[model samples]
Structures are given as structure tokens and as C-alpha cells.
Target chain A: MTLIETILSVGFVAQALRVTVPYALAALGGTLAERAGVVSLALEGMLLFGAFTATLGSALGGPALGALCGIVGGLLVAAVYELIVVRWRADQVVCAIAINLLVLGLTRTLLVLVWGSASSSPRVPGLGSTGTWAFVAAAAVLALALSELVRRTPWGLRLRAAGERPDALASLGVDVERVRWGAVLASGALAGLGGAWLALDVGGFSDAMSSGRGYIALAAVVSGKWRPLGATAACLLFGVAGALELNLQAEATSLPRELVQMLPYVVTLIAVSSVARGARAPSALGQPLG
Target chain B: MSWDRGDSGASASSSHGGAWTALYVTLVALLVALLAASLLVIAFDESPARVFALVVAHTLGEPYGAGQALFRATTLVFTGLSVALAHRAGLFNVGAEGQLVAGSFACAALGAALPAGTPAVLALPAVLLAAAAAGGAVGAIPGVLRARFGAHEVITTIMLNFVVSGAVLFVARTWLFAPETIHTRAVVPGATIPALGLGGSAVSWAAVLALACALGVTWLLTRSRFGFELRAVGQNPDAARAGGVNVGRMTVIAMAAAGALAGLAGSGTVLGYKHYFEKGLGADAGFTGIAVALLARGNPLAVLPAALLFALLAEGGLAAGARVPREIVDVMLAVIVIVLAVAAAETRRVRASAGDGA
Candidate 1:
């Protein structure tokens, strides 16, 4: 019950980071895509694909090359996603869900075919143990800068305008589609790195390694009001909840561990509901610019 | 993601034929995909002819396989009904898995604590009722939040699924099932529904019960005043409200009803098959229910056939000697679902554009 004890508890910090890393990265990706006016729901699918590809890449090559492969893989998926939503003008929500299903199966099937194992954990040069927390910090900083750039820079302003009102932006001579494409690809890369973090840092490439964190990240982005710093903080909060659950279980707390585990999700629900009315998403976020 | 400003207006003035046509195109697209998938299977050394034959053979192979499929379909039918019903009200109940799990947990508790001398007939219904109530309550949470607070049901529903599963796993492991067994205790014989004797495979009377429930729901959806309100709300909430429908209440009630149906499905699994609530019993029934609703085009009557189709594919895929990697079925299903969703969205877009043109 002591404040010092609570802060020092291994469960608190570990659970917080364990939950925060993937979510923070994914939400950052979501912030980028949404900021550019595209609803990048493919974040979840991309996350899974990232995990699968990174593991596969590391297994075949090494960690660095594998991470590169994951980036490529993710961008490739984003391109396909762009084709569907951008070219065909498909409903982004459905397209994103389909993409999730597609990646989920494709990765699992491909893994089976190639690695002959559903759970593919590759031995590769991961971020050294000492650098684990460093990676998380760097990710948070990068996301903050990227989000700030999207808001402050001329390029960021144009991208925001393209998402807000395409006719106005197009009249200004900006190709809305091109801007969205770049944003989406960037989104994929960030989401892919998030996946890489999961594979390399979180237990190596289990089938359900992402475990719906992609969706959770989406919630984080929404709950964070689609701001980089807000989303990161939200991710950290959920991470703390998750890490706390583990430690609570370790301490053999009388409160059911399951209920404790439910905290993050419950928090997400409460946060989303509370903020939904006040949150101002980009006006034209899901609206495809002509 | 490109957002299409598909006229989501609630007007029957737009040609209804467009919706039908969209459905038609979707069906054709699905059939084409199936044909292509079948050919792919054939290319893998199994004759296309033999594949269909085996599907038929394994599905209707014996009284047992057929019975099992029917039983499986019964559970799916209710879950599918859960999804379809909610869709009619424009609420996506993706947490059917959670609702179902929660219902099963409640049902197990109800069955275990029932008085020793209770009659089988009364006991069964009582257990089911308890399940429905519990599941319905859980379903109502998101419904209430969405109605009252405008919370996105998608996020809440997905999160709820995890919450339910995690909670159920812990409770089942620690409290309900003796830790020794690691699952809930068996339902008392009086609480169990007797299965129809089909050689080898046991078909629960629950199948007939589920079929009846499906018919009743279909009737309620198509013939009742509530159905009209539900459709109006789903098709256009703003319009429904202007027309005097309490859209919020309708959403909440619809979710509760859908949850009840899903709860019944979960109870069927426990009361008829396992007689105990086990971890992972609901599996992906909740999510699969979405595909079922879509495949059935949100028709309560059609959910039966769609559920049966999925059950057949699932059972057939796993049957020894099928020669197909079961995941292929998942791929086929996914393809069908995406294509259908696209077709639906496209039809909506085309009509909207035409209206805008006018």
C-alpha cells in the first residue's frame, strides 16, 4: 500500500512497458495516417504482418535485414490497401478489416509453408537487453517529432488540408492522392516497426503475438484524440495496467488476476467513451479526396 | 483509407432494386470465388468432381456426421441470428464470443446450484434463462454506452470480448471448476437436454429448438412492429428518430435480444454437448457469427443455411481424408466476405451517386 512500494513493484513498470511499446508505436502510425486524412485501420493487419515478416526475415537473414524486410512487407501491404481504398474507393473500414483477415491468414499460412512451424521465433541480433528501454524511448521521441512535423511544417499543413478539404487543397495544386499515399506508406513503416518491436522484444513471433494490440492501438489513437503525445501517454497508461496485472499475479494478490488483466481494456472503453464527444478527429479523415 | 460518401440516407425512395442487385452481384462473386477455390483444390490432385462429392459424402456421410453438422449448425445458427438481428438494428455485436462465454459461465453456475430434485424440463429452461439474462446484460453495456454516450461500439465490443474471455478463463479455472478438473462441473442430468439418437453422433433437441428460435426471430424481424423500427433505425438513425422511433432504446433492446440468442447458443453447447463450461468453448463463434450474418445478408431465415454451410465446411475440412488444408476454407471464407462487403459498399455508392446526380 506504500507509495514507494507501489513505484518499486516490478509488476508496475514491466506491465506498463510491455503494454505500452506496441500500442505506442501503432498509435503513432495511426496518428500519421489519420493526420493525413486516411483512416489507416490496416494498422492491426500491418502489425501482424510486421511481426510475421520480421520473424521470417530474421530467421532467413539477421535482425537488421529482417527489420528492413518487415518495413518493405508493411509498405507493400499499405500499397495494396491504398489501391483498394484510394483507387477503387472501397469503404476504408471494410477494406481495413479485410486486410487484417488477409494478413492474419497469409502470414500464418506462409509461416507454415516456409518455417514448418506456426510459432516462428528466429534467433537474430535483437536490440541488446540494455537497449530495450532505449528503443521505447526513441520510438516515443520519433513519434512526437513526426506528429509535430505533420502539424507544424508546410508539408504537414498541406497534408492536413488535403484530409480536411480536398477541393481546396487540389485547387492549391496539391495532389491529394499522392499525399495520402505517402502518409499511408509512412503509417505502414511505423506500424511495421511496432511489429518488429513485438517480435524482437516481446516473446519472439508466436502466432498471436500481436494479440489484438493493433486494435488496442487504434483505440489508443482515438482515445488520445489522434495526437502523438496523447496517444503515447495513453499507451503508457495501458502498459502500466498490463504490467501491473502481471506483477499482481506474481504477488498472488487475492483479487482475481483476470479482473486485473481486464483493466486496460476497461480503461480503454472508459477513455474512448469519455473522450468521444469532445475528440475532434480530422474533418475529412475517412473522406477520400477526389 | 478513401472514404466514400455513400448516401447513408434512410429513404425507401431510392430504388430498392439496387440493394437486391448488390446482393445478387455479391452472390455471383461469392460463387465465382468458390468455383475458383474449388479449381485450386482440384489442381492440388483432387478431382473437382471428387471434392464436391466428398463434401457431400463427408457432410451426409452418415447419420453421425450429419447429426454433428446439424448440432454444430444449431450453435452457429443462434450466433448467426445474434449477428443478423443486431445488423438489422445497425449495431455490430462483435463480442458474441464474449457474450456467449459469459452465458456459458452463468449457465454452468445455474446448473450446478439447481436443487437436486428439479425436473429436467424446468431445469433446462431455467439454466438457459439464466444464461440469456447474463449475456443480455453484458450485451446491454455497449448498447447503453453507444446509445447514451455515442461510444463507438466497435472498440467497446472488441475490448469486451477480451475482457469476457479473460475473466471467464480465470473464474472457470479458480472458482467454478474444481482446480483439479480445470473446467466447470458437469451439468446435472436433469439440466441437460437429451440428444436425438443418431448413430454415433448425437443431435440435441437443441437443434430443433434452435431452428424454432430462428423461425421465431425471422418472424419477429419481418412481421412485427419492432422489426420495422429496427430496420428504420438501422437504415437511418436520424430518420428513424424524426419518425418518432426511440433509436437509443431500439439499439439497446436489439443488442439485448441478440445477446440472448447468443447465450442460447452457448447454453446449447454446454447443456447438450459438454455438460460443462470449458475454457475456449466459445472459440471464435462470436467473430464467425459476423461472417454468417454477412453471408446470409442479415436475413434471420437465411442464417440457418449460412450457419450450416460454415459448419459443413468446418466439419468437412477437419474430417480425415479430406486432403484440404483447413485453412484454405478460412481463406475462401475471407475472400467471400471481403468480396461481398465490397459489393455491398459499391451498390450503396452507386445508388448514392445516382441520387446526387439527380
Candidate 2:
């Protein structure tokens, strides 16, 4: 309420950065797929499966091994989605929803059968154990590198062309499916990293840890016009909103946390509506490639 | 989007028979998966035979279990109809969860505020109408925004789901919550639907009402003039606009109607089953509606059976207990939906090829 109190709130803002790290990572992944002409709605399930695998791997193996397992798990799931939607020309949206549902069941089943727990795993080696800020720094650097790669690389141009006009890309002798496949795989990997960060970096696995962050990442991807740097900025803004809400709740602040919590979603929607208007999405974002 | 089913070996006069075959195959495949899943449980040093038997005995083998299944189906019917209706207008109504929750809040508030002296006939419709208005308004927001600004409906609807959930949760805690319990005060008896006592379980006439609503929507879509226009707009908006159909108006109307269906679901929860609104009551209603609509291929009549099947699986999953693991139902549902999506995609491709040839 006072100037000093408002200045002290900066600490909570810093705290929110911790929450934003995973979201930024996930949104970055979504940005890749969307840029490549695929609406990867399976991010939610991919995140969940990745988290479960990472938790299981760390519980059985080490945290490093768990992270690798998560990446592999994400790739495997993405492969299935790509095969059905891209290769077989299935409805991409429904395929993504199916992946979400299938993984929800499979992951919950795995939790009960393997870990004998419903929501979480035993505390294993975690990113927090190494250093809390380490994961955040790594993510930011990855975001910057990927952003540059997307804008500068020949491969990025081909990927963009594939999304823009697969038929035209095919006419130019570029295998559109192959390019899209690579993008899908990359998207999965990034989402997996986000999931691993949530489970290993943040805390042990929790059933709803991903919550709707995967969906929010979709919002971020749209709001950012499928650009990596733009998405990173959007994710940070959302993260700050989340951080503010948590801190408000913590200090028993009289202001309604729910209303504050609504801010991120509202902002994301507005950002998406504004950004998506002029910016062209992947011409065939939701369409299955023949 | 009519299918000939000519690829099947059925005669022209018997083409309707091919539909029956597809339906049968889908059901059989689902059952086989359930069987295989249950067998896996047995392989895990558990008694597969016992678990399978228990699931059947509990879900289908008992009278009470069937009643509960119907109750679950009643809620899903509204959601299924909601999604199906939107699909008919080529709109994805992903905000059903939010609309449902909003409806629940309104139903709760109205149910609480109404006097005990009001007649049941007058009060029941009032509560339902309040819910429909609330839910329909929520559904219309994305539709109206999209119509006016060309803003994408999918993202806005999804975002709204969270907003509605959070808003309702806040309302529940601050305004509608009873002094004692965390939930809202009980609705006046006049506002509640009378439940039928069957096999020691209370069966809400809501199922009958749901059936009537489903039938009403089906007839409206297939037989009514507006239904023809909505379908035309759904199939090809540009073409529909060329033909004098107001694409934007149809989108809003269809979405609003869909929202009313979902709202009815929430109202049913308060008026038929629970007397008060609770958090997490929606769980996965909106998401599940996607699967339901896909399974039905946007056919309102087909949605009834599709929703019923899903409801049975959900209810049966719980009754099946530790052996089946409730998640198994989700697995079956996911597979079924994916299969349907693939089928629909294939159908579209084949139709496109035919058009090209023409």
C-alpha cells in the first residue's frame, strides 16, 4: 500500500520468475510447432507425460537420467501425434486432444502402478538442489539461441515455408512433412524440458503441476505470433501476473487474488487477439498435410 | 456432409444398415479394449477374473449401478449437446466448463434467494432460466468477439474457462457460501427436481428431461429452417454468406444455444442432484464434450448414444474399483475419439477426392 511496501513487492516479482521459467519453456516449444504450421494442442499431455517420466526416471535413475528420459518420452509422444496427424492426415486438433486424454490416463496409471502414488514422486535429485536460478538461466539462454536460430538459419526458412505453403514447398522439392516432423520433434523436446523443470527443477512431480500452463503456452505462442523471443516476453508477463497473485495471497493481501489471477489469462487473450490479427499464422496450422 | 457408405458392400436401399455395422464395430472394439485392459490387471498378480466380474456386477450387473450411470449420463447429455450444437455451426465451444460453472453459480444464487413459499412449478423454471441466461451469456462472449473482430474463438474460449472457474470459486467463497458449510445454502424444496427412488438410488427425472432436450435439438437441427441455414453456414461460411445466410449471426446463435445446453447441465446439478454449487464440479466437462462431439460426428441424435456411452464408462470406471483403475475409461475414451477423428478425416479426404474428380 505504501511506496516502501510496493518496492518490497519486487521480491515477490522475483519469486514469480521461478514460476515463469517452465511456462516460458513450454510456450517456446509451442511457438516452434505453430511456426511450422502445426497446432500442437498435445502440449498439455506431453508436459504431463514428460513430468511423470522425469520423476520416474529420477526416482529410479538420477536427475540427469530423468531429464533425458523426459526428452525421450516427449519425442515418443510427439512421434505418435505426428504419425497420425501429419503422415496419416488425421484431424490435428482431435489427434492432439486424444493425446491429452490418452496421456492423462497412461500417466495416472503409471503413477499408481510404478510409484504407488497418485500425484507425486519421492524427492530425488532436483534443479533446486543444485541452484534455484540455474534452470532459469539455462532456459533464458536456450530461448535466446533458439530465437536466433529460427530467424537466421536456412533450416528455419524451410520450416517457415513448409508452414506457409506446404504445396508450394513441395513444388520447390522441399519435403514438407520432413520439415514439419522436425519442428514437431523440437516442440516436444522443449515442452519436455519445461516439464522436467517443473518436476525436477521446481519440486517433485505433482498431478496438476502443469495445470493449464500448457494451454497458456498455446496462448503465448499465438500472442507472440509464433516467434520465440515474442513468446518469451509474453510468458514473462504471464509469469509476473502469476507471481503477483501468489505474493498477494501469501501476505494475506485484502485484494482478491482470484481477480489478480484472472489478469494473466485476460492479458494473454488480448495479446493473442491483437498479435494474431496482422501476423499470419502457419497457413495450415490446424490442417492435416496430405 | 452426408455419407453414402457405398464403400461398404451394402446395397443402396440398405445403406442405413451400414451405419449399424459401423456402430457395432466401434462398440465391440471398445469392449475388447476394456477386456484386454482388465486382463492386464490380472497379470499384475491381481485376479483379472474377479476384477472383470466385479466391474460388470457393480456397473451393469446391479440395478443401483445402472441408476448411477444414468445420473452421470444426465449431466453429460447437456455437455454433449452443447458441443454438438456448436460443431454444427462449425464452431468449437471449448468453454462449456466455464459456462457450466457460471450456470451453477447462478443456479445456486437464485436457488438460495428464492422464498420457500414459491410454488415448485414457478420456481424450477426460474432457476433453470437463470442458469441458461448466465451460461448462454458466457458462451456468447467469444462468439460475439469473433464475429465483430475476427478474433480467434478457440483461445478466448479456453481462456474464459479458467476465468469462469476462478470467478465462480470466488463467488462461492465470498457470496453464496452458507455460514457453516463451505458450499452454498440448500435450494428451497420447490426449486429441486423430484427424484425417482429406484433400487435404493435416487434417479433424477433430469435424464428424461435430457432425452427430451436432445430430441428437441435433433429435430430442430434436422427439420427446422434455421437448422438448414446453420448447417449451410457450418459447411462453408463463404458459400452460406453468398446464399444470404448471416454467418456471424449464426455463429453467435449456435454458440449461445450450445451454452444454454451446458448451462442446463449445471442447473441440473443444482436442481436435480446437489442442492448447492461446489468447486471442481465441472472437472473435465468442457474437454470431455470435445470427445463426445467428435464421436457423434456433430450429429445431435448420435450425440445421445455417444454421451451415454461415455457416461457409462465414467460411472462404471468408479464402480469398477481398484481393479480397473478409473483411468482406464479415459484410455478407452481417448482411443475411441482418436479413431473417430481419423475416420472423419478419412471421410473428408475421400469426399474431396470425389469432388476433384467431378
Candidate 3:
């Protein structure tokens, strides 16, 4: 096949789409939380926990239950985050970092306890091809739904208010804390789903399998200017990069694998820096509510 | 608003009080972290008190353990100072990890190139300087981006980390790859730091250097004019710029300085301990430094004790790995950082309310 034909192959597109799913889902979730003014460096930890719980639940029950368990795991971490950031009013970034560390240790400990190894879990049932397609469609629907929710709905208005003008929102008798808590919880659930998609697709969990996808998702959130559709597009763009990298790895490229591996991160850095000037975060994004 | 001699005395006393308060809060946070860690131990079906005793004995009671703790603290001290220095300039330097890798790579590359019988005075300084310069250059990328493009330092630094990690691996494979192992060739004998005579421990002169650097950083931050400007920018950039301080220049300098410190950390691992550049060395130290700095409340002098505490925990974790997972130490570190963050915020809230009341 010609180079162009190879590049445009149906298999390549499918693979790219597959890669895009988790990023799109996680970025959308990040958008929800950041829109409500919560910084989420813990997305990595949340993703790992979700994957671990999903694997464990799959082993115990089935894929459906595994996904549900993943959401719960994410929610548990999110609750701790809320307690620290919203209730105690800690520095959001520091709290997020702490959460990431805590979850990492917790997941590793649990993995060793249950699986008898810290590396990878035993094979479990996964969402088959049909479920994968369903998830992709659901992600697309979520992107559109969230975009509408943020732009057209009153709840969206309140969430934006909680992020940008918490005092004003509080003065209007809307509980800013409640709005933020809801957003954070929903965000966790979505991120958990994304992570579950990763594990179920692979039929098992590996140590550090999420592997900085959470940070990349955050980059997408920034590059997309905190908009749902924009973030999804950014995720697709990264997914394409990832797919290209994989393609290159298969071919006999003279470039070292390490340099090729760096392509996505370099692209992310450039994209984030370029779009940073155009993007404006919420006015009170990282501030504790007074 | 008054700039009088009498006000200077009052201000000094107030600052002292603030330091004391930070110390007290940090102690309380440590206590809370230990309590949480104890609960984790209980969940593991072990007696928390017994585990705690074992950890303490393994970390501090034995001479070899004490030396290992000090060795670990030597590296943490540099990275902790790196984070603390950047924090003073209002920059969250998440790239310390990358900078450290760059430094270690530089040290290994340069030390390997040195002639076998070169003098220690010449070879040692060359490798150290090379590492610091490389790390500073890597660090300056995010600094420049932030200063010139208004890019958020946090994002840029984090992105740079992956880039650095990948680049380091590529370079190590292409230029410094050892045929049999995943690490580079050992440094020349002149380049290797001599171990301190500490009961067969791997402790080296890096510990002394770390302490000296800590003292140096404390003086630089507290007594120097540059430090005053850096702190001003951290407190309020607009005010600092309005007062004729070059905020942009200071940002770049602070980041570079922070990166250089992290590079020194890499040097401690390579020159003082490993004597060769390995792929995974000094990776976790960079992240752990954040916890150390937070616990220290960004005080350079306080970093020593904070790093020592973390080092003890790390050593203790390894020693007690059979009974309790070493990851529990990481949980404790995270808990401490979170508690300190909350405590710091609470103090700020109280101070603000008091100002309003006044």
C-alpha cells in the first residue's frame, strides 16, 4: 500500500479513535471539575484507582459491576479531596498532589494484597467490541451534553458562578459548596469511567498503566480553553499523535523510540503554551471560598 | 505604612512570631500524619505501636540505618531547597524531577569522559558544574515560557518533565548506554566522592555539602537583597514591579537557581552514592521534595529537619518492608503535606480576619 493509503487506513482510524476515547472522557471530566474551580492533579491517582477497582470488581463479579465499582473508587477519593479543599480550605494544588500520592500508595497496597503482586492483575472479563463502541458514543453524547449544561442550563450557570464568583453565588442563596461538590463528584465519576475503559479494554490492570494520561488530559483541558467540545477536539488531536507514534514504532524508523515517545508531550507543551494566552481560567479558580 | 526604626523592631518580632507559629503548625501536622499512618498499619493486621518502634529503631537507633538516613537526606535537602526557593518566587517548579535527571546525566557523561588519573579537584568540580548548568538550562525553558508567553509555570514545568525524561532516556541509550546494564559507565576514580567512615555505611561528603548548601540558601533568602526582591515578587508581583524590582528577571533567576539545586541533588546520587548514572535514580526525590518544602513552610533552614524526617521515614520503610508495605511511607508523606497545606491556609485566614478586625 502507498504511504497515504496506509495513513488513511480504516484500521489506523479505528485505533486512533480507540486511543481518543479515554483522553476525551478524562478531559471532559477535568473540564467539569475545573469549571467549578477545583484543580485536579489527582486525576492520575483517580484514574489508577478506577482501573484497579474495575479490575478487582471484574474478577469478583462482571464488567458492569466493575465499571460501577470504578466509579465508587473515584468518588471515594473525590470525597477526601472535597474534605480537604472545600471543607478545610487547603491549598488546592497541594491537596491535589497529596491526593495523587495517597491514591498511588493505596492502590499499590491494595494491588499487592488482592493480586499477590504489585505489577499487574490477573486477566478479567472486559467490555467487548460492542461495549467499546457504546462507550465511544456515550463519550460523544457526554461532550455535547456537558457543553449544553455549561452553556445553557441554570445548574451550569451556578457552577460557573461557584468557580468565578463564589461570593456572589453565595449571596444569591445558592450553596456554592454544594454546587462545587456536585461538580467534583460528577467529574470523578467520569474520570473513573475513562480509567475503567482503559483497564477493561486491556482486560487487566498494570502498575502505572494510566501513565500520565491524566496530566495530558489536563493539558487538553487547558488547550481546549476549558470548553467541553474544545477539550474533546484536543483529546482527539493527542489521540492522533499517540496513534502516529504507535505506527512509527511498528515501522523501522531510524529515530530512537525514546524521542518518538516524546512526541506527544512536546506537542502538548507547545499546544498548551500557544493556547495559554488565549485561554482565561475562572477568576477564583484556585482560591478557597471565603 | 510607617518606615521608622521603632517599626523595624516590631516587624522583626512579628516575623519571629510567624516563624514560631509555622513551626508549631508543622509539628501538629506531622502528628496528624503519623496518626493517619498508624491507622494504615492497623489495617495491615500489625500492631501500630510495634511497627512504629521497629521503624524508629531501624531508621535512627542503628548506626548503619542512621548513615543511610543521612545519605537519603543529603539528596532530599537539595531538591527540597530547590522547591522552597522557587516557592519563594511564586513559581511551582514541578520540573525539579526533570532538572535532576538532566544534572545526573550531565554528571555521568562528564565524569565518564574525564581521564582516569585526573585530579579530584579538577574532575569533581567540572562534573558538578556541568550538572548544575545543564539542569539550570532545562529549568530555564519553563521560566522563559512563563515570563515571555504568560504560560502557566505549573503546566509548562509538568510538560517539561516528560520531555526531559524521554530525552534523558534517548541520550542515555545513544551516547552513554552500557552494553550489559541499563546504566552508564562508572565515573573516573577522581570523580567519585569518597565515603565517610560511618560504620560501613555508604554515606559520603555529600551530607556535609548538603548542610552547607542549606545554610547558604538560608543566608541568601533571609539576608540578601536578591532574596528580598524575590520574596517581594512572591508576595505580590505587581507591587514588586511597581517598586522597581525586575519581576520577570527574578522569575527566570529563581527558576534557574531552583533547577541548579535539583542538579546538585542529582550529583549527590551519582557522584556521592551510585558513581554511575542509572535510569531511575533521583526520580522520586524530586516529588518528595515538594512534601519536604511544604512541611518546612518554604523556609530554607527548616528544610534540613524536614528532609531528615522524610529520610528517616524512607529508610524505615525499607527496613520494615517485610511487615508493612514501604508505600505506607508515601501515604504518610502525602498526609503530612495535606495537613500542612490546610494548616497554612487556616493561618492565613486567621491573619486576614485579624487584619480586618484591627
Candidate 4:
């Protein structure tokens, strides 16, 4: 089939939706956090931790318990983050980088200690036949739900105020810190769901499996201008790039695999750097509140 | 060296106590990191005190270990200074790994192409300049993108890393490899850096060059008018632009300079140690620099001690890993970074409550 025809084909659309699951879920969570003025650099770490716990929990029970365990794992990371960045008021970007490194090392160590392998764990009974279709549907629902809730709810109004001007929230007797905490934790839970989906899809956990999806999700949040719907769509754009790369890899062309592997990042860079004119970030993003 | 990245004057945490505060924060962070690390070891059924002692002994107590620590610190010093310089201009250059790759590739490629048995005088400077130019060009990419296209330096630099690595990989695999190996052909003996004769270790004249660069960077950042404007840009780009400073130009120049510094770190691995450009030659040399630069509080001169400390832990931690896991050392390093950030915040709070600089 021609490239255009292939892109419009049902098979390609299904492949694209499957590829976009992690990015869509993580980006939606990121939008919520960035809208509340947190940079959410810990998304990558949370995803890794959540994936790990999901695998571990699956080994103990099944996908149902595994999902709960994954979220709790993500919340564990969020608790530490809150302590460092919010409670102690450290530089958000700095702390986020530190926390990411810590997670990378800790997860590797845990894998070695628990599974006797530093690279990957043994297979476990995880999310079986339904596959990423479940997460794809869930992410779409959450994205639209978040869009409406932010537009209509009082909590969403307070979230916007916290991001745009925490001082305004404070003047109105709203606990800005509480709102930030909630936003960060909520972001963590959603990212955790992404992680669980990832582990369940593979039926096991691998070292650095989340790779840079957390970061890609951050790009989606920025390019989407911190709106849930916009961010989800941006993630779908990345998914399109992934699907195209995969299709090209499977074709008869002699394109280099290394170059093919680089397609998504190239697309992301161009997309992010190209439209800097209209993208406005939350004012208090990455700043430590007084 | 300021960490005051447009904090809206609400928390000038990095600037409160100057040298004393930096010293206090470093020590406190070390203590906290050690205590936390010890707790981790105890939970894993290992003795923290023994692990600490073993690490120190392996890294500092013996001549060979000392040489290894200094060897590792050599690359880190270059990269630490690289990160610290850009940081002083309020940009985080996370692509040091790629920049180093470019430099080493250029350095090796040029060195191999030199005339057989060429004189060191003409050969060395030409090869070194090639390294710096290649690295600087790679580094300038993110700078140019951010300056002209308004890309976030952090993201652009990271994306550039994967792009550069892939490009280099394709090039190396296609034409640059010596045979079936990952490295290029060995450079001529004239291009090799003289070893320092520390018990046959890889430590070489690059150590001396690292020190020289640090001294040069310290002077450049403090004495030059360039340094003044760069610091101004870092502290507040808006104010600096208001005061007639070219913020975008400074940002680009700062990133390029930082990339050059990181690129020069390849000298130790290529000319001094392997005599060829190997894939993954500068392992963790780029990322570890971030920790080193942060530990140095963005100060060019202070990077020396901070790099030394990290090198000891890394080398010593490997030695200690016979009984204790080496990843624990990574965890400790991360804790140090987090604690130092918290200390910066606390310092600002103390100064605020004290009615002046505390």
C-alpha cells in the first residue's frame, strides 16, 4: 500500500493507538501537574517505580492487585518528592533530577536483590489479552474528563490560580500548598497507571524500560500548552511518529535501524522547538514557593 | 556561579552566605547523605561503617587506588567545569556526553590522519583544536536552537544527545572503525599524551591540562567583562537585557564554551589512555559532571574538590561492592544532591528571617 493509504488504514490506526498509550497517560498526568505550577520532572522516575512494583505485585498476585501496587509505588515516589520540593521548598528542577537518578539506581539495585538479575525480571501474570486497548480507552476518558473538570470545577479554578499566581490563592484564604500536593499526587497516580500498563503489556519489567517516555510526555505537556486535551493530542502525534517508524522498519526499504530508532526524538525536537512562539508555560512552574 | 534563575526575588537561595554558606551546605549534605546511605546498608544487612572504611581505603589509602581516583577525577574536572560554566549563565547543558563523543571522534580521526612520526609540536595543537572545534560546534547547536528558535535548552540539549550519538554511531560503523572493532585506528605516537608514570596507570599530562583549564575558567568567569555579563544573564536575563546585555548571544556562547570544556575531557581517554576513539569511552563522565558542578555550587574553582570527592566515592564504591552493592553509592550521591538543594532553600530562609545576610 502507499504511505498515505497505510496511514489511513485500520491496522495502522490500531498500531498508533497502542504506541500512544504510555505517552498519552503520562502527558495527561503531566498537564494536571504543570497546570498546578509543578514542573513534574519526577514523572520518569514514577513510571519506572510503578512498573517495577507492578511486576513485583503481579508475581505475588495478579493484574488487579498489581495495578494497586503500581500506584502505591508511584505515590511512594511522590511522597519523597513532596518532602523535598514542596515541604522544604527546594529548587524543583534540581530536586527532580536528583530524584530521577536515585530511582534509576534504586530500581536497578532492587532488581538485583529481588530477582537476581539487573536487567529484567522473570515473567509474571499481568494484563493479558485485552492489551494496551484498555489504557488507550482509559487515557482518552481521563483526558476529556480532565478538560471538562478544569473548565467547570471550583477545584480546577483554584489549581489554575495556584499555577498562575499562588499569591492570589493565598490572599483568598485557599491553602495553595494543599492544592499543589493534591495536584502532584494526582499526577503521580496517573503516571503510575501508565507504568502498570507498560509492565502488563510486556508481562515483566526491564531496566530503564520507561526509557524517556516521561520526558516525551513533558514535551507533550509543553507543546500542548498544559491543557489535558491538547497534551493528549500531542501525544497522539508522537504515537504517529512511532507507528511510522515501526512500519518503515517492517518494510522492504534498506533504511538504517539506528536512524529509524531516532525518528521519534527528531520529530519531538522539531515539534517542540518550532512552535515556541505561542507556547506559554505556567508562571510559577519550577519555582519554589515562599 | 549563581543558581538564582529568575526566582522573582522570592528565594535567592544560592546567594545567601557566599563561600561560608557553600562550605556549610556541602558538609551538611555529606553528613546527611552518609547517614541515609548507612540506613540503606543496614536494611540490606550490611555494615555501613565497614563499607565506608573500605571505600576510603580503596580510593585514598594506596598509591594505585589514588592514581585511579585521580585518573577518574581528570575527566570529571573538565566536565564539571564545563557544566559549571554554562550553569553560571543559567543554562543546563545536558549533552556533554554527545559533545565529548564529537570531540573524541574528531580528535581520533585527525590524529590518525596525521603524517607518520610527525613532530609533537605541530601535531598536538592541531589535534587538540580539532577536538575543541568539533565539540564546540555540537554544543552550539542547542544554544543556537534555544537562542533563535526559543527551544528549552534542557530538552534540546537532551534530544541533541541521542541525535549526535546516532549520527556518530552511523559514521563510525560505516567508515571510521579500524577493523571490526568499535574504536578508530590508534593515533600516531607523536600525538599521544605523556603518561605521568604513576605506577603504569593511565593518568597523564591531561591532569595538568585539567588544572590549567580550571584556573583559566576561574579567571575567565571572575575577571573578564564576559564573565560579568554572563553572570548578569544568569542572575536575571530580563534585567541583563534591560542593562543592554545580549542575553541570547551570551546564552549561545556560554553553551558553546561549556561544550568545548566537556569535549576537551576526551583528551584523557583518547590521547592519554586508549590512543583511539572508542564507543562509550567517556562513561558517565558527562552525567557525573552535573553532580560535580552542583556540588561545586557552579563555582569554577570549587569543581576541583567536588570532582575529587565524587571520583573517590565512585572508585571506592566499586571496591566496596565486594561486600556492599555499588548502587548504594549512586543512591548516596543522589541524596547529597537533594540535601544540598534543601540546604540552599533553608539558607535563604535563614537569611530572610535574620533581617540581612546571615
- Tell me the tens digit of each residue's lDDT in model 4 across B1-358: 2244665233324544477877877889889888977887786688888888888887778777888888889989989998888888888877888898889889999999999889999889988888988889989988988889887877777777778777887788788898879889999888889888786767889888899999999899889999988888887899999999999999889999999998898998899888999877785677788889988877778899999999888888789778766887778888998888887778767767887645
List the TM values for chain B, per candidate. Answer: 0.86, 0.89, 0.93, 0.92
What is the Å distance of residue A46 in model 4 from its true position?
A: 1.1
| Error at B229, model 4, angstroms | 1.5
Best-fitting candidate, measured by DockQ? Answer: 4
Q: List TM-score per model, in order.
A: 0.89, 0.92, 0.95, 0.95
Tell me each candidate's RMSD, in Å, in order.
3.6, 3.8, 3.6, 2.2
Stretches > 4 Å off in candidate 2: A1-13, A129-132, B1-18, B28-36, B39-44, B47-49, B350-358
User: At residue A22, what lDDT does model 3 achieve?
Assistant: 84
Taking the tens digit of each residue's C-alpha lDDT, what string does model 1 give over B93-154? Answer: 77788889889889988898888788988998899898899889888888988888777777
Give a tens-digit lDDT track for model 2, residues B125-149. Answer: 8998999899999999888867776
Model 4, stretches more than 4 Å misplaced? A1-5, B1-4, B7-20, B356-358
* Ten-residue stretch with the least lDDT total in model 3 chain A: A1-10
User: Scored by Cα lDDT, where does model 4 land?
Assistant: 0.84
TM-score for predicted model 2 compared with the true structure: 0.92
Q: Which stretches of candidate 1 lie over 4 Å from their true place?
A: A1-18, A119-125, A130-134, A166-175, A253-255, A284-290, B1-56, B320-325, B352-358
lDDT of 2 by residue, A71-160 (tens): 877787888888878887776766787788788887776667776778766687776445557768877898898888889999888888
Off by over 4 Å in 3: A1-4, B1-15, B18-20
